[model samples]
Target: MTRPQPRPGIDEIKPYVPGSAVTGFDGPVYKLASNESALGPSPKAMEAYEAAAGKLHIYPDGSARVLREALAARYGLAPELIVCGAGSDEILQLLCKAYLGPGDNIVMSRHGFSVYHILAQGCGASTKFAEEKNLTADVDALLAQVDENTRILFIANPNNPTGTAISGEELARLREGLREDVLLVVDAAYAEYMDWVDYDEGTSLVRAAIGTGAENTVMTRTFSKIYGLGGLRLGWAYCPPSIAEVLNKVRGPFNVSLSAIEAGVAAVSDDEFVDDNRDHNRRERARVTQRLRGLGFEVGDSHGNFVLAKGRGDAPVEDVTALIEFLKTRGVTVRQMGGYFLPDYVRISIGSTEANDVCLNAISEFASQ
Candidate 1:
């Protein structure tokens, strides 16, 4: 008898390559590969997680109502417009499932998150990548790529790996230029940490779309970054009421875990912890960018909690491949950006002072070689 075969596009999909978490020489390893909070979760969130341990047998609330209300209150959004998922990643996958299919396509920047491609194609859809300029998402270029088959356009605000972002005006222009039917999915996973004046996480656009009855835009955010809830895997999307209703229909009855809902509610309420983490990331990002540039490396203009550093000097240091091998030997693990199509750059997450210093010291030594 013949076995069941997988779908057509599934075979073409390349699995996402996550950042390195360990080095072979593991003496006091400093893991800075994934862009996560070094400051850790808030005390209140920790307490909430612990509180959830006693209720392990009870099923989680299928609607995730409490967490939805908390996110609405924190962001000044309507609870009815929010949808919670395992992570912003799940939210993206849900969108692909809802909107895309065979012969359909999603357009995005060439350097946008790899998961977008994975999510779209896994659902039997294709991806269209527009070019970028000056390491930033070019709005006109993206708009130019949108044709009749384009069902969704995904963009990572303060895009990962490169950590560069486009402004609100450019985003608005792109939205207005698109046909009313296409969905605009903005992945603002790094929104909380950005102190930029013009970045609004696409909330305003989503609201405006609702007001005009277009309801063509939405923004996805995560608890993994500033909230330090990576392990819990909680995230939400602020969408028009219609979109939220559609997502609720297809998602699992208890899509989010009890612990995640409890921890997320506590995490959003702790404004102080969030502020402190943002401040630390802001300061360290500046310091690290400056230090990397001073050491003769080309660092991207990053607005997220990490920076993209490329070797630009002579000899082995100029080759990022060698630089990564060198850092690995020193018990340091930073992400190689080749998967994101950035072969010459290494993306380093901003860590606590000691972690950052150790990572920098290792790089400094490599620069001297």
Candidate 2:
């Protein structure tokens, strides 16, 4: 008997492993592993979500018009150029499926989001990883890896695992260096947490792409980070009209649920809540970074709501594992960076003051030992 075989690249695609949430400890767990919001979702969004319960029998608008319009009004973007998705993950996959083929490839920073490789490979395309500089995406390195068959370039602003970001000038240089035919996907999932003077969340680049008629750049944003809507799985992309059309064609007609649409509309409109969340993340991230450095760990300046840290001396991997084990015993959990090729480091999401203290205290005790 003959069995149906998967496509060539499908076999090569390593499944995407998400941040771990499980902890052997049964007590109150501080789950900083997933980088979720510390303060949780907005009250208005929650109210809207609760109200949406009545409409569970109804299907969401195929176009998600209200949510798109709300997003446009909030960001000063064109409604027609916005495409909503289950999450930025779906948007990324859609782009890969649309542009990549058997011989095509995508270029990304070596430590960029791991999902990009899986998505490209799922489309029968290969992935090229360019070397990074100081845990940040390097424009020259990424462009150097691009070949004639490279159809896409993915950059996660304020990249995960490392939590380092490139400046706006650097982003512009990268875009200018890329071929016009190549698509530049800027994943701005953690954009709300970035308050650096030179950093950009990618809206300006998307707008510039529209103004210059380049139409090659796309910026994807998520409610999962700042809005605390990860469970709802809501995200949208600010695309050029042409790319928006393609995504709309490829995405499910009702890709976004009624509850997500309602909650998203309320969440985006809650400017006060977003500002508060940003401020909280900024303060806590800085404090955590300073504390980690004080504890003799090498911590970098992070623009996102997380920090990447490692031991100062030779055996960083062992040090990280020991710290993680200790934190777990204290009911606090963080992430290891092995999947990002940074096994020596650990990625800790900035949480509430109590949670941060728990993690820090655990590390301090471990250090004392």
Candidate 3:
């Protein structure tokens, strides 16, 4: 029999694991695994989706023009600068494919979003894991790792698993120090949850680069988080017009679905819904983080919809495992951070007040035990 052949990198790649979606467990399970909005989709977006369902037979606009226009208008950017994708994940992959190849390298934080490493490896590109300080991207450390061969740098604002953010000044410094040829891809997937005065989604950075005729910065955004459109799988990237053109060439023409396009357009226009969700997440994230820290866990300062708490520092791993199990029995599903290389930490998403109460109670009980 003939053996199936594959690329060496493909063989080494591990598939991403989504949060469990099992229903009808012994107790009611409040899933906080995936960093999704608990508020659900906006009424406007749902209406648009329902209206578009009848037109499923027709192919989606290849350029996603409607959604692009909506996003551009909202962001004060040119429509030509945007490239929509299935999700920000796809946009990240596109950047990797367009810019990275064998012999090229990308710089990323040690515990940044997994997609950066996955996409880099998928393209047969090497990665330099910049040492993070306090679970946040250390811009200076990342700058030190850059070389001529480093084609891309990915920074996840409000980084996953740890939910820590780098300040705007630090980001600007990193950009100033970066090699002219290196492209910075800022992933602002959780930008809406931030209430910091100096926090930026990297839009200004991208705009500054464009003004300077520098084509080395791109920023990605998603409809999945604050918009509650994870199921729609809609995301976009803002880049130099030249880079956007290259990505468009490599991207599948019909990468986005009809329903997704309609939902994305409506979602972007629903400012009230987005604002309300952001406000709720900001308030609850503080509440959750404070409560977790009060329980003697070292919780990081989070600017995202999730808060990460490090269990007892000197405690055994089994002790943490036991706490997780106890919480699972209480129907609160938080993300275990072993995969993200933080074994003593668990990430809990900011949910509705009631859901958060249940999770806090579970944690309290586990601590008492």
Top model number, lDDT:
2
lDDT of 3 at 223: 90
Across residues 1-369, which tens digit of lDDT does each residue of candidate 3 receive?
A: 889877568778777767655344586778888988979887789999999978999998999999999999998989989999999999998889889888889999999887788888888888899998878889888998998899999999878877888778888888888877899999999888877898888988888788778878999999999999998898999998778989999999999999999988898889899889988988888899899889888888888889888878577366567777777778877777776777777888888898899999989988886
lDDT for 191 in candidate 2 is 88
Off by over 4 Å in 2: none
lDDT, candidate 2, residue 253? 91
Spell out the clash pairs found in candidate 3: none
Alpha-carbon RMSD, candidate 1: 1.4
Candidate 2, 29-95: lDDT as tens digits? 8888889988899878999999999889998999999999999998888899999999889999899
lDDT of 2: 0.90
Under the 3 Å rule for N, CA and C atoms, how many clashes does model 2 have? 0
What's the TM-score of each model vs. the native? 0.97, 0.97, 0.96
Off by over 4 Å in 1: 313-318
Model 1, range 1-369, lDDT digits (tens) per residue? 899989988888889877776635848888788888979888789999999999999999999999999988888989988999999999998999999999999999998999999999998988899999977899999999999999999989989867898888888988888899999999999988777788768999999899989999999999999999998999999999889989998888999999999999999999999889999998999999999999988897898899998867564234788878888888778887877788777889999988999989988998887
